[model samples]
Target: MEYMRTVGRWRRVVRRVAAVAAVLVPLAVVSVVTAGPAQATGCRTNAHVYLTSVYPSSYRFENQPVDGGTDDYQMFAGDSTSFQVGGNGLRPYTSPAWRVESNVSGSFVFNGRVAGGNCVANETTVGLARHTVAGEVWTVRANYLTGNSGQFIQNQAHFRIFFVDPPPPEPWYWQPCYYAEACF
Candidate 1:
């Protein structure tokens, strides 16, 4: 009789525990389903995009005044696609600040930091410049939206990171005044 009672008590305890778990399990699952991947905040204004590496060989990706430029050479700034280094206006100041209408997809429009044309990647002639990369701060899987026809290449990498930052200020120049100009 005692054995029967003990068995009945265990069965009741199991039933109670399962009933609690049945209610809690669904809530936990529902929370996970509702939470999805975070969205990209798009590009910033007046920002300088640089390789995340600090090595001397680490270089900034720049554009040629060609029909378009790199964003054509490789998918991300850190990808292993080697290319010809140096081109016309392939300097740091010449490389335009990237403005994204979306995260790292669709079109990566230039902030017009450079003149004439912006998104030109002439793979045939003056191709993009790449350096002995060290590492990248972050990355972007962006498809080059050429100002020219048909578009040259598209960046298809899923999720990635690239660093786009504001250019650091130089303390050399006095902002309020310039050469030979008297202070007001």
Candidate 2:
């Protein structure tokens, strides 16, 4: 009789262990499966638009006479500048023109024009540019033109280089296991 009771106790212990393992094994597997891919995947980057301009004396007046005497109205001083991103191969993003006013005495009347619309890209992937990777730098050319009275006068060119960093990877989830497993 004692031996029978011992056997029964041992059986009960084994059953309890099996039940606990059944509950725990799936949880362990789910955590591993869900976490492994997110950690293992490589980083990714996306391209975006950015514009930076200097204040005061950044642009010249077009069509105005030099010293108000010479017909040579080159980049005088005070007007908005247009910048193009990418190059001849891509359509340039043009910035709004800023007007500059100056007195004949070399004194600045109006320094620069204020930006009116949205200028920067909010998303990582913008327009037709391919997604950028971490540590990648892009060289963009800007063609500047100044105009007055609807006539273009002075022309200048510049370049802007931008650096990109990879964005964080998305988390991973096993859809089927998540829905099917009863031990959620």
Native-vs-model 2 lDDT? 0.32
lDDT tens digits, residue span 75-160, model 2:
21222323322111111232322222222222111111221122222212112223333343333222222211222323222222
Q: After best superposition, candidate 2 residue 8: deviation in angstroms?
A: 0.5
Residue ranges of candidate 2 with Cα displaced over 4 Å:
41-184
* TM match of model 1 to true structure: 0.26
Give the TM-score of each candidate.
Answer: 0.26, 0.26
Candidate 1 total steric clashes: 13
Against the reference, the lDDT scores of all candidates come to 0.34, 0.32
Candidate 1 regions exceeding 4 Å error are 37-184
- Shift in Å, residue 175, candidate 2: 81
